[model samples]
Target chain A: MVNPLEIKVERNKHKKTKPPQDQLGFGVHFTDHMFVMDYAQEKGWYHPRIVPYQPIVLDPAAKVFHYGQTIFEGLKAYRTGDGRTLLFRPQKNIERMNRSNERLSVPQLDEALFLSALQQLIAADQDWIPSGAGTSLYIRPFVIATQPALGVSPSEHYQFIIIMSPVGAYYPEGINPVKIFVEAEYVRAVIGGVGEAKTAGNYAAGLKAQEAAKELGYSQVLWLDGVHRTYIEEVGSMNVFFKINGTVLTPALNGSILDGITRSSMIQLLKHLDIPIEERMISIEELYEAGRNGTLEEAFGTGTAAVISPIGELSWKGEKLVIQDGQTGELSKKLYDTLTGIQKGSLADPFGWMVEVSETPSGVL
Target chain B: MVNPLEIKVERNKHKKTKPPQDQLGFGVHFTDHMFVMDYAQEKGWYHPRIVPYQPIVLDPAAKVFHYGQTIFEGLKAYRTGDGRTLLFRPQKNIERMNRSNERLSVPQLDEALFLSALQQLIAADQDWIPSGAGTSLYIRPFVIATQPALGVSPSEHYQFIIIMSPVGAYYPEGINPVKIFVEAEYVRAVIGGVGEAKTAGNYAAGLKAQEAAKELGYSQVLWLDGVHRTYIEEVGSMNVFFKINGTVLTPALNGSILDGITRSSMIQLLKHLDIPIEERMISIEELYEAGRNGTLEEAFGTGTAAVISPIGELSWKGEKLVIQDGQTGELSKKLYDTLTGIQKGSLADPFGWMVEVSETPSGVL
Candidate 1:
């Protein structure tokens, strides 16, 4: 194993002008530098460095282009009011990324090395972290197969990379509930497939269903389990939760549903708040029944991008079910405020979910 | 739609020495030139051309690396003793690729334009087609999302490319039967997923199971349907067929299984030979029962890479059932000889499966 502290750095000569804070959209503008490491079957991972952010060159026959052996993780770095940079639950994202690597048959990355790369890369480009009220630096860590072979077997070469983009809040106009269409035609993933992994193909599989929903004026598609086609799986790319009667219910960690970091955090936060929550299989029919009986108090999706995307309406089988009269629920508001407040360092991090970046210069090891 | 004949060509300045015919392996060495086209949401497909085989430059945030919005097709061009290049069922492959594009939410290519690109690319690099026995040029046509964005949606930009590699026989020592392991713990695909499409994620999802089967001294894994673990779906990357009581049985066109061209051709060839063939679901238990009853005659897989890969032994649930005494059956050998004969132009093409590339210079439009 390579030493995590022995990292090399190559500063970008020409720095890019940062975009205006008000115009910072999600994943549009990127920082000036990135972290990269190469993996070979015989040499393992080597040449870990932070270099200029630029286009990557790859052979057209790279296994990633054909076999899709790739995985990714998403997190954010918040710029505190005291000029400190903080990352929330980064270890959870790193652990989940390794699990995704195992599922995709890619080599496992050393957790220390992975964490060091993120810390150094963020430290090198700390000024790119937007200090706006609802803005931060969105971090994307990904791995791709780079072997220039067309075989179906696992690749012998890989590249791990981390890129950061400054972004505004998901809901720039304040958090409003979204209309979701319950998908019945296309499936995202099955229990035996790669749904649980943060892999590329799972997202690709949902594009068609999401597009169809979008054409019908729905913001997202609520995916159902591939086998039964009735059990709830996910909402677009997020883990879904619902408030039924007085208890919160989210789908259990079945092999097909993603173990979302935000979903876990929400569960912990609800428990800490003395609210009842259940993790079990939930069918769409049962959810609709709760809606008919006025027991479906609120519904929302949890992920890194949106954090807590409240669901205002759900359309399934030509029927529309509006939750909380097509408005955000009180509980969703409370959870969103508390979560964002902790993330931005405006409130106490009672769960100790934040990790502050070291201020030491990260240019040399 | 772009005109099929308006393709430009840029020849390579320095040509590398070709590998010896005996050392040629599958998809390891590429030809001198490759076909390329760009697709945009507003302008459609444009700038179709053939250029020197080289690495592709892509932004670090290209969607293909993150969302897996990609599709591909595999076919081969055989060089006849008369010095003519023959492509087997190219139209079918192009059609299937479009279906995959639809499933992955990618823009569809014009069939005529796709065929023209293939024909031109082959014509430009016709010298790369090996004329030795059991040697041909493997053609890989693929499309990848190229939009430099990190969102979980279909990409607005795409790149279509075709690369060629000269390859020798899949089994250099003649047609030897392979041992297959029946995978019980992992599933390949379920209906309502992207299984029917030739996308990257489906292949990535199977790598873990395939690697495990490899460690067990098996050549490939016999995949079961994701929903029902008992019904057989596919073997490795190919469609499987079994002969029992003098009748050939293969799985029907389930949505989770690929519609293989070689499988279709084999079905047609069997009917032409006055042999009975049935397309229906066959369970592993049923196949094992036939093995015990002395009715299992031959088993084989069909695909572009290995036209006919005969199965000698099957291991499942800690039980091994040897077929035809772990040797290639008589029918398997006959089918391989006939199909290869037709492909290489040594025999009559009864079904008109070969499409001969026109003898025209493809350097300029």
Candidate 2:
């Protein structure tokens, strides 16, 4: 009784026109094929399959619609300098996604099954992987509660899906710095909440503040802790880092900050380069003091979407503070180049982070 | 052109079976007809109609599934003594729902249109309204983002739907007391978050703490303030109140505490009865002190689901503080009776809160 994924190719009666790579935005366009699986309490996960990209039909009372019981992960498949495709640390995303599943009470997937689904789906839609520089096929693996009940409890049924979208470089302006608003009025995540989990509710809670900040001419909102509203937590949807006095510092994962994959990779890369790095609580007051003393050399945000988003300005409580003369810091550029280089298969695989689609066992593809 | 709600009756080609009245649970049973409307940036809200209840079709990348950008409202339709259908101050729920819509970045609904939809839908399914004591048709109106793009932004398209279910009494064992665990470690919401709005994320964040409390033999978890973790915010999903030595008090409507309709009605009723009531911050330390001094006479929670849920025991940290010897307090019982009586049309309507479904204009029906 080995439950394996059954692949079904979409019969294209009409050939779909692919969008121009230069015109493509983040997640507006999707590939033709998608991976889907179901979970029930009695039979567990079953009926894994790849099907045509189409509308998902659900009962109106499904738990995902009413209770926000869903989790998701995002990574990318980069078309290498050669004809092959590469995935950076795909296994790490799967591991973190499982942790997110544990927190949201959604059922976890077998690691092999999860990896096989992604590899095969990417293999089937391999042509959709864009070859433009800094362009890649973004992979979204998410699980949603499918039970058609209107209760607040965890759902007994779930659906795991993997969808692909070809995306352009995150910074259309090319490794530019973004303006941030220090949100003293809104808190993103607090200790002992669903902050660590990559769930939808945490993102929903930040939308209001994000909208307001965008109106205020800021690209993102820098969130503070929920308790004191002083300690720095994150920047927009990404975990943040600060370079003060030759030290690379990020907020410690105090159960509220998300353990971002890109954040970890950047830290590893910085350590490998023999740069000082620390993960600890950094308050706004301390950061401002360092800025005043000219010790705040650089600040940036790290996430899958924007690998390294340098912070140029921070407006905190009507006080504007400029960082590094509003320029992308030297370290920020170096780290971004190194990581994206590794992702595009143009650099040596010292860390063995790149996983190729063809590397999976033959039976899956 | 006037945008009137078009009515479509289900043919019942196959007759539907109704669940037994005695076995009807909270949201398991649904009425035959449901109200639905669509919204777009250019067209506003259009295509208002009542259609047969069925599954909702959406793209897998819908914003509601990924970002939790959805809001909902809950109110009940009651069948009165003389076979009249009544809705208790439903306009208040609509107004609150609109506010929730605003906070969650959803489009605001037209008040008249919202009320008309409810009245017509309830009228169409009037026979489904349960006549059993303490039973009524639960109305749920929700808006979800229908856009297929996978970005964390306010959706361009939306769907608003109203579904009803005939539900039994919240407590089958009569209006008894429930044991509450004072959750010092977990926080449901913080100031400047979406706690006040009746959104899905706040409930999702509470499921874990609620599950832990239920496992520990507690019926609900009482959340503290997200900032200090000292002030009492809410009990489970309901707004909380405490009666200490004859003074009735509830947490002030800070941005985080939901402005519950039942809570407001209870406060009004208390004022009418000449019992002093105050909406201000009340600390747990003060509450425990009152318990130790025998001054904490009564406690209860208020919401649409449970009109008035009395609290009998509170387990905070290691100590168990039993209120009124683990029995329902006098005020709790009186308030429940008065509220339920008004809802059922068994009492004189002094404040003119109950709105009759048959009283609406003919064009709406």
Candidate 3:
């Protein structure tokens, strides 16, 4: 039998009213529609649907519930200054998801098919996109193993889904700087591990350290090399960037750090701007000493969610090295402003990052 | 309002008969009934029941599908020669489950209630237990995050489940030693990581290496320390033990090595037998040198499923080291025989290790 995806439309019948502006936070309120597709070995991907966001019933013995064969990507759909909804390099998320699937040993889907499905779901839920400053519909596209088994190997069946939640400004007040603890005792990823993949285990492994850091009054935990535990890595969920003596410096994408899409874009943007940006292994001691000598200008983390989150203090083992008085640095703000400007359609899209995908590409609108 | 476990049972009207004694392999067949319970924030741990063993239905966005918020335990029940079932130290599994619950931030179930639930299910489907030599029904009790969301944190709700599968001897064809590849380039767990917990992420992280080793004609991978990458940590899914210079040594229970229930029981048995034993960090180079100089006589891995598994050779970095010429060593056989005898009710109950919970405890035929 020739099988294909049966694209179904199940609109929400009992959608709740939008939450008040003040109560809206990150990932708390989801949109009415969510995109979903299922995969089996013989049938491949089938039953692509945009259905009402509802409770998903699953077997208690599903493999993803037992073995963590799951991966996810985070991006956002922007409401342009002229009120047009656009996507920012959504193909990057698709590519990352495929890479992550390869690492997790899940099935790979056509990137174009995934993008089209995402467009359909977002269009159906466009009104849910917040339009204010630094606000957008945070899109989460993910894949998981749905087979019911207790084995350690890959699952035979899978599910790919796209869920959207309207998010407010990352920082409620304004763009703010926070301190991150340089975790020496705990390591996030190691060589030959799933450090580069956007898989679930990586985040789950970092939860305890994140909780401990929050208890210590820090916002995030900056991971170091698993071996030796000295070299700098990413900060919690985002890639780290540093500005030393008018040059953009970040840790090179080693086997143990995530090759973040935002980090790559920022590097490309810096290169285009004719900045001397170096991707090399920068140690914690070197950064701290540079900060002491008044040479470390700024440090920030780059990701699709927060864009560019400024780091003001590096709290090492009992040593507090303030990069810049617990405040957002000038370079951090400039990068954030340029990035958000392009995303929000206030500035020119020099890099061709934004793609208008609402109606039928360019013709239907 | 009074609370009762709300179960929607879907019975399996047809089930294949249990295979003959010779064909039964580990984790290959299941019983008729399985135990399940669900937990939510407002309704904590509801819906406990014994349902037919079948594939589970799941939500596409369940938190375990994306965050690896899952943990599990391995246990077994044996049918004694006089026709009574016995479970060896199930309390240990319960305690470990509680510890795992704390680490993953999942809720804990009362030990008494949990045991009663499992016993009820087992009693309901007790015919699946096999009475042949080294054959028993393996019990897998696990907890998973059943919440549906897209962000990373502790899951608000979870599910606790128990599934059983009948299995024959791990080494039914006589205990022959197996070769393993020593993995220095990869690290399974690091300091302050979730190595002590029997979490899915740990097993998931080891899959690629295990697959590579199996493809290279080895049975499993010998994991090393995440830091330094030289110290021996564990065998995949088992605890490593080395018989060096007539003294038994296993890797110390650092935060990165799981505290295997069988490993502990074997050590206690060895101590009772007046054999020398120590739990400390053992380096790979040291083991190689000892093997070369004839100081290392035997090596083995211990776990719940395979009570004791002997290792005969190790392939590392293009060097194939012949450990014991693929022969099951004397210590390995001795330890295995003792443990199996105790578990199967063939040996005397020394140190009060085995808690025989048959159909009627302390009753005669």
Candidate 4:
């Protein structure tokens, strides 16, 4: 176990002016400080510190640059109405990060140490947490293999760093529906691959497909299973859900689909609200059939970046399937409101999902 | 086109002692200087230069660190018996690097600039090339997205770099056959993914499977196709070949397998020698059946790192299929010698595959 007291703090001598909250776009503006820890095969993880946000110096032959042995987690620090900072189920992200580490053959980070680092860093930079409607400080915790050798095996050194960015609301005005293209020519992941892990390579593999979808004027790509090429896997980088005949359906955790924290939370929320939900293999053909038969009521993508992204249209193989008349469905809006309300502390917490952060740096309890 | 004369050269002032030829390992010790070029959306690729080999400075939020937006190519510089330096099939690698860039949504590099960079870099560090038996300078050319943003998209900035390392013979004593494990639980790549590209993520995805194989007392993992989980894709990171009943068979250029330069050379060599060669799908079942019937004469893997690595034994689902009586097949030895001979400028350049590097730096062609 790492002692919280051992975490050194190096305050920034010169801090940049903070950008206006309204002008902050996604991942554009960063905070003053970042949390960093190093890992060596012989020394374990050491030198946890909160230092000025700066450029990282790495050998050109670092394994992360050549082999992509990296993993990351995304969550947010929300400013509640009561002037308190809250995080939505951060423990889940930490747990999933470890699972990613296991899959990527990177070293495991101590859960307590992870949480402590997050808390201390958040407390130090809490002023960057935006209070605007639907706005929050996005926390990105990533681990990269830092071994300066050009080997194809697990790296002998690593760096776990946490950087925070003040992101504007995904939807500036309101939760608008997005247009998605069903990708048939490119695949994101397959069964028994690294899709379930929040690793860098999975995202790298999807860039071409995403670019193609963009050129076709779609906001994202809805990926199918690489094997059958029919079963739904993900919408862009998010988990997909469809309300067909009043029953919510999502692709099960079948080894390839990411176990999205937001997706899991939405499922729990749906069950609490007494809405029927099912996790199974939902093929694109079945989804299109539901659209044609007028049984597909609503569709949405769930992720940390966008609490709930309503899907208004899905274009697949030259056919456009418009749901809810290309509008945000009632259930989609309701889920979005409920989830964001809980995250921002406007509504009563039913499942105790929100974890509050101390305003003062307590040096990681 | 990048002007060769525009490339600025800055030599290293204090060079470190070069490692002994006998002590050289694969990609362990780098030369004193490296080639670098920067790319920006607005400026394009510029600032081509040679500088002292040092650590690269990048923002913590660089896309390569978070999304694995990177690609690399591997080739070797061989010091001939008469002191001339040669590069085997470098144009193939340069063409393949651009193909990888296209697949990964990265900016395409000029093929002329790539070759010039390799030639100049190798020329500048010509003294580092080892001349001992089976020693060569391994050249690693790579591009990494350097945009410091967390958005999961193609980066607007990139850095292309070339580094060289002196490497000893893959098998210092002689060509040795290795034991391979046919992986079923994990997949290296799938059709419509980044597998065919020589990108970082594909290698990262294979690390876990390779580690598992190493733990099971195997030197490498023979990957099966992601969709079928039976059709052969690759052995470790190399293209696989099987010789059965006097005919050489390799997997077709499926989107899930890398098109290795050595594999291509071997095919051409087989044709030159009037040996039968076929490129098509061959499943593990068929291979094991051939082993059972004593028709699986030989097996080997081809890549730039080892040139040709013979496989003596394969373990699949608790069955050990020994090939060529656990010894290096005659064809494997002949192919290795022929290829290495051509690379080192010791044998006749029948196909003109070897490109000689100028002793003096010729900035660019």
Candidate 5:
């Protein structure tokens, strides 16, 4: 029988004992160790290890550095109220990672192997997980081309790494409101591009627009269709949701906009709460008009890190449309509460999304 | 008077000797040193140097690795009959790199600085230039977000680098014809994506299609429009051109096909040679009909590396359209020769395209 691959971890010899409340921004503080697996054409993924948090060395000609052949997944390791560490729906991340890898022509890895590796790595670095109020160990699993070839062909070698960062609340004080810029000139995703995939290229393409929005006093950009720049796609990293009349409307996954884990969770959560949700194309005109007529009750964005962030005002095309009470709406708070509650084990995980981590040798076998 | 920036050379102590002629494939042989510059929001671009060609150490959380915030420009240094090294249309590359940086939200580098860096790098790597026929030093100038952050925002820190690789002729035995696989299912670029920009993401997106074509024993995938997947975009990295009724036609630069340096160069060369050339939307239907009606004389793909590679056959929709003679056609060879002639200083630089890199460095104080 094939042995369950294990990782060796060297704990941080000098550990910090202070519970600093300031070390809580999302993706700011990382755990001590990380999981890594290397792959080559000659030999499959090997040299799996849990190494101390350090820089990765790569060839200057590596395709990932110059060509951007990279994809990543975001999930979290939450410490429950019951004092148990659990991962939420990690299989989804594994499956999506493969899909992205396939699209980018990166070498693929075993999903079961990946999940086990994550479990082991996180177990070792679990102490680095921040507890208390909306804080959790953010798990970032990513794969990249490591081949040193400079030609424009698919790389034969690859690296799959799982790194953990203790992240604070997305919103400093629970969930407040955010001003979003309606990006018209800049398009994040197109009909046939890597918009749906969590590829680095998609995110990189949005940086300028995001920078512009931030300078203009906007938190994020609400991307539109690349063709006509009319319909909404996504808000930088999150999936957008708009409440028009009664139905919660989100732009349908039309080959653009990331199929976010939180977006999917919200859809499932709405089903449990018996709330009507419509997954269809939501145009900018419809959103603006609905806001002006008071038909828009709320607008928010969903992603793994930020369970739900309310939209206060949309700055776009010489007009500012106020969404809801210019603050976190009731429905947005409800979604965040339920999701976080279930995550922290305060509420029962009836959906069986959380996989409880076994405390033995920690992440090592 | 602004003094010209001087490059500090840190040569590799253990540099490998140049490989033999047979092994000198395109982009396979690198020079001893590379030029680098670092940019940050706080300090702008600084620490410009020509360092040893070695593997770069990058943090696992570098944005370029995870977010793909990278862009690159390609040009070549050819050894002229008088033993002088030259870059063809180097300013065009600088201009294009900035355009690409704008699309990716990376900072724009000064054109003067870019040329100076290139000159220094090439001077240091001049020994690597192959003197044989059709051999030149392929220069890859790229910018990558080196910020050790996981966020999707535009990185505050960026690394700009220029590396040289001595490359042999694309086709060792004269210009050989290539078979193309027209991918109907997968679309490379769309209406408003980074297709026009020489960004890393655009290349990453095409890898899968290229792999599929390779698996099928074809050279490259002929991409089409994303929505309809009908109109011809380009074949992999190069712009496709077809000769019908003694007139040359190429797919219009309609946001999908790259505005290739060689593509435009050929158009200029053909027009100067009294050949009628049109840059307009080219459809798959038009190509197939033209090929079948014996009106299509030649078809070729143009890029920096292989200035003009003739398309032998096209496999699409269960049908095959064999280009005339299924060999390097007359117009293809003419276009290739004319372009190379200008590039090699054999012909006049009519458009004032070639910017001579003066050895004396007289432009600066």
Candidate 6:
């Protein structure tokens, strides 16, 4: 467990100058410090500390490199207008990460310790938090198998690390709607697989289709269920949503689709706003039929990085469907504003999703 | 590409003492030297060299750690009776690795460069080769995305590393047949996924089912197709085959089953022997019916590690099916002898598969 009093902080002797706020792109630049904890089968988890951000040296035979025994969580820290920082529903991310660990056979992490560790690391790198509009410090917490062996079983040793990167808008075009390609030739996951968990393998297995979609001038690929290849599962790395005839619908968690925190929050927000929403299987054919009948009102992808990414167009099997006249939909805009407002402390905390930095022990440092 | 005269080798300053030959297990022990090369989008692949086996230093945000953008090939260097070392179908492994690279969006390595690299590495650690019966030096050549960024796309930088480990018999019980649990609840791969590719994610997605099978007292799991969960896919990490009524049947490469080098070689050998074999979809139901009627004469799994692993028993959905009275079939023994005989260079090299070490620059080195 992370004890704010017990966490050893090793300050960097030579600190790197922060990149220009506007130039920050995704996970390209890292903050000064990182939080790390080690896990062994016999000793469990030990040695929680904050140290200078540096490359990790691992044996060539580490299982993480060979078997892809790794899991990760991604969230962002928003700098409010009043100079306060906030994290939106970070406990959900930690809970999902533990589920991922269970599927990957990694040890379960204590949720309170995990949250405290993130707060400590954020405290150590508070200067890196960007205050620019649509800019925030992206936090990536991951666990990797470090046992120096080539066997395919679960590793005996593991390392849990949290790294921070100041990132701008997820899409370079800001909140604009983007074109998507419906992938039918490849599958990201199947039922009874590790797709529900935030493991590295799902992304690795998806690179080929993603690259192809990018080359075809599409922003991302809309993946279908592996078994049926008919029902929509996700869009790129985000959970997808569609507004058909004034009803919001997203895919159900059918063992292969990731249970994204952003997607859940959006569902809750939609319900709060008195909008009808349902989590069910939405097939491409049905969506296209709705498009033909002028009932496909809005579509978007929800994730931690993008919050809400509107889908302007979808091309499936050589057929193209323009969504909302290739523009950002009204609901997508409202959801994004409401969510970001809560995250940045600009609105009243109705649902109480945001956890302010001052509420944690960051002030103690 | 592998000009023996052009290769540079660095010997380890502190050589590791060899473990007992018979006690050598799987990938726990490493040789002194390893093959390494680097690739950048601008520089292609450069700096091919043999260095002392050591840990690889990488930024915490390297794509391989976060997205599992890694591909690997596994083969062995076998010491012949004439005191020469050989690699069985080494080029096949390279070709398969290239296919895996394409699927994982990793850069493809030149086959010539890959072969030369292996020979150079084996040359540097020739002394570590074990001479005991059934002992061979296992070589694992893998490529990983090394770009220090977390954004999920093709990596701009990569590393190709080859490490060797001396291993004894794959099964401690010799060639005895083992029980296999038919996995109906979990699917290893689907038709439109990275199942055929030799990537880390495929293996990582399979650990849970494998662990559960082991706990059920089974040697490995017999995977079914992801869509139907009826057609047989593979057995653990190996390709499976069955002999029914003097005819051999194996699941076709239907874009899901791995094109195992050993499986291909066995097919070629069976064709040469005028044996009838079919590479088509074979369902567990059909096999079970044959087992009940006593027409399923032999069942075996093939891979680089275990050339012919007999399946003595199969438990599908709690229905037990025993074959050959829980004994190794006659054909299983014959195929094992023939494959191992070809690999060790004690038998005829009719297929021209074995690449002798002396044929390359190893003798000069």
Model 5 per-residue lDDT at A54: 77
Off by over 4 Å in 4: A171-174, A361-365, B171-174, B363-365
Model 1 chain A worst lDDT window (10 residues): A356-365
> Which DockQ-derived CAPRI band holds candidate 3?
acceptable
Task: State how far residue A17 of model 6 sits from its true place (Å).
Answer: 0.4
The residue-by-residue lDDT of candidate 1 on B1-365, one tens digit each, is 88876888898888878999988988889999999999999999999989999998999999999999999999999999898889999999999999999999999999998998999899888889999987899999999999998877899999999999999876544578988999998887888888899999999999998998889988889999888788999987899999999999999988999999999999999999999999999999999999999999999999999899899999998999999998989999999999999999999999999999876734443
Candidate 4 residue A316 Cα shift, in angstroms, is 0.5
Measured with C-alpha atoms, the lDDT of residue B148 in candidate 2 is 81
Report the C-alpha lDDT of model 6 over A226-278, residue by residue, as the tens digit: 88889999976799999999999999999999999999999999999999999
Winner on DockQ between 1 and 6 is 1
For model 6, report DockQ.
0.85
lDDT (Cα, tens digit) per residue for candidate 1, span A178-273:
999999888888877889999999999999988999899888999999888999989876899999999999999999899999999999999999
Answer with 1 or 3, whichever has the higher lDDT: 1
Give the lDDT of residue B309 in candidate 5: 85
For candidate 2, what is the lDDT? 0.87
Give each prediction's root-mean-square deviation over alpha carbons. 1.3, 2.0, 3.7, 1.3, 2.5, 1.6
> Native-contact recovery for every candidate?
0.85, 0.70, 0.51, 0.86, 0.77, 0.84
Q: Is candidate 3 or candidate 6 better by lDDT?
A: 6
CA lDDT, candidate 3, residue B187: 70
Please give the ranking of all candidate structures by TM-score, highest first, separated by commas: 4, 1, 6, 2, 5, 3
All candidates in order of lDDT, best leading: 1, 4, 6, 2, 5, 3
Residue lDDT tens for model 5, B1-365: 11236556676788787897557897766889887888889978887777889778877888888888898999998877777777888888999999988888888988887888888777766778777778778999999898887766788999998888888876444478888999876667776667888988888888877888888878888998875667888887688999998899988887666888888888888888899999888889988999989999999999898878899999998799899778899888877887787777787778777766555443321
State every prediction's TM-score relative to the real structure. Answer: 0.98, 0.96, 0.90, 0.99, 0.95, 0.98
Candidates, DockQ = 0.87, 0.75, 0.48, 0.88, 0.67, 0.85
In angstroms, how far off is B303's CA in candidate 2?
A: 1.1
Instruction: Please give the RMSD of candidate 2 to the true structure.
Output: 2.0
Q: Which ten residues in a row have the lowest lDDT in candidate 2 chain B?
A: B6-15
- Model 1 interface CAPRI class: high
Interface RMSD of 6: 0.8
